[model samples]
Target: MRYRLSIEDMEPNHWVVWVLDLPACFSSAQTPVDAVALAPGRISAYYSWLSSHDSSLPVITESIEVEIVETFHSFASTQDQEYLVNAFFEDDRRPPNYWDVELALRLLQWTRQDLLKVVQSATQEQLSRPMVCEVRGSIAGIIKHIAGAENWYFDQLDLALDRAQLPDDPLDMLKAVRTNTRAQLVKLMGNERITKNCDELWSARKVIRRTLWHERDHTQHIAHLLAHL
Candidate 1:
């Protein structure tokens, strides 16, 4: 039977060719198309040659599941500034590996809160007001941009954004971000080589570390912009 595989469905790390059959299976690398003759007898000869080879195949494991969710804010000043900063400070713990969905989720949540704090502190006006900012567009724009950018990361894990797929309400967005991100993390945990969607943007490390660095990078960007203002 023929099998089809989507880029997102491809296993992380190592080149993997999955068999699109029931129960979900995968295969290792294949030989060059030009290597063998198209003779009927060539097939058995190839298998015999393969059996004679003194080598062992690598072990393949099942995929991990990760869940992702979005967060929304509906606060004036204190809620936006103090609460978010405090929450982020509390959730700053990280797991040794991004393979752990629980740790990744916790770090993601902390980074989200950290971003909100930067937005609250960086904005010139407490309430909604037009002001020229360089990196950060606006307070609301910052929130939306963060949500959208994070969704890109979720897409790498083959999960839909909760805010986009399921609901749009603030509380619901937060819940969805949490759920989907976690599921995605779980999906990739067992992968021996975690494939990163944007290797140019980050190294081949776990997405959790890249995420923290991304948030920190943006925070510094906003800080530089705000400093000039």
Candidate 2:
């Protein structure tokens, strides 16, 4: 029942909080305490709405894992980067030289949750609204592009997942693709034979960098679109 939460400083006197485990559950407040205070109500409303639409929705418990990334002050410090680097290298149980893959998985989880916050909040009307600038596609179309690209990246690892027709709900489609990508990543990272067989283009280093970049790029795009909405 526990869920993860990610909080980031958005601007002076404003903080954005996201329930990482729950799609579309985000709130902003002028203070970090207020931001944290808003989470329960937002979560309750999300579950209430979900239950009204589908009786099978599970109940959420009070437990939470919170990760606060405050970027307004400064970028990640050396200590923070070192912590991530150490965590990536110290887990020796994983296949040798798979640190990049593991790091990518961690980052993907963060970016996907950020992306979901926007997708969940968008109305059908908003999703269909035409883009005004040079950036191609409507909000929903861009989301589909993000999911589609992840699927394509998995294919580069020689792990072919059966492509299903995209669902009308952007969140649903994203969840499906994210699940498949994570599975493929785990399989590839754990298997030395598979890793060795992969082409240089799909090397863990390249794959991790490209995947993170793609996710972050589109996440920013979604944020921009939401700002316009």
Candidate 3:
């Protein structure tokens, strides 16, 4: 199968290739070629992961093929402005059925668990040790980013949370945001709503997509960070 891809190239060598057919399935790398190179493996892994909870997708083969169907680039960081994929794809508007939502919820739950496990035994000093980089500051910053971005994805759909009173403990904050975000995600099952804020576009599917992607992205990030310590 030739999978369709959506590439988001942002400032400073950030390249993310999104598999439009698979919600929340994305691969990132420092260059476009490397990013695209990683997509086949991500596609294979996603099928195995999806099949764990729902055995509907066909058994994936070893050989995976992909083509760049959509491309968006920004010279500045995506975090600094309206992000990529301004308009929803044809598949984006299709309201998720009960099965879709349930599968997504399962994926989210597992992804979060993986993230927590990576940082389970890190010392406070290790968590807060400053490291100069982009939005990713330190281990603690990654945790905060994971939590904050989860809540913000909900905000895109007008499914707002009381961000002002969020918990400060990194783990507590992660749990709280995910709990609320899951509630919001549940409401999105069969929802046919899509909203535009500024020039950015979002839908129930989009929110789920971005939320899962961010969680998985940072989980691997934290795991790599932990490997060095």
Best by lDDT: 3
Q: Which is the winner by lDDT between candidate 1 and candidate 2? A: 2
CA RMSD (A), model 2: 10.5
Q: What is the C-alpha RMSD of each candidate to the true structure, in Å?
A: 20.2, 10.5, 3.4
Clashing pairs in 2: none
Residue 195, model 3: Cα distance from true site in angstroms: 1.8
* Candidate 3 C-alpha lDDT tens digits along 1-229: 8899988765468888889877668888999899999999999988887676567767687678999987776443245454443435556777888888987888887787777777887888989888776366789989988999889878988786788999888889998998887787778888898887655667888788778888888888887877786
**Candidate 3 ranges with C-alpha deviation above 4 Å:** 48-59, 75-88, 134-136
Off by over 4 Å in 2: 1-99, 132-135, 164-168, 190-200
Listed in order, each prediction's TM-score against the native is 0.40, 0.50, 0.84
- The whole-model lDDT of each prediction reads 0.38, 0.59, 0.80
Which candidate leads the pack in TM-score? 3
**Candidate order by lDDT, highest to lowest?**
3, 2, 1
Clashing pairs in 3: none
Better structure of 2 and 3 per TM-score: 3
Worst 10 residues of 1 by lDDT: 83-92
Q: Candidate 1 overall Cα lDDT vs. reference? A: 0.38
The digit string of per-residue lDDT tens for model 1 on 151-223 reads 5555544454644474544334545665666566665544444333322121112344434435544655555
Candidate 1, residue 43: Cα displacement in angstroms equals: 56
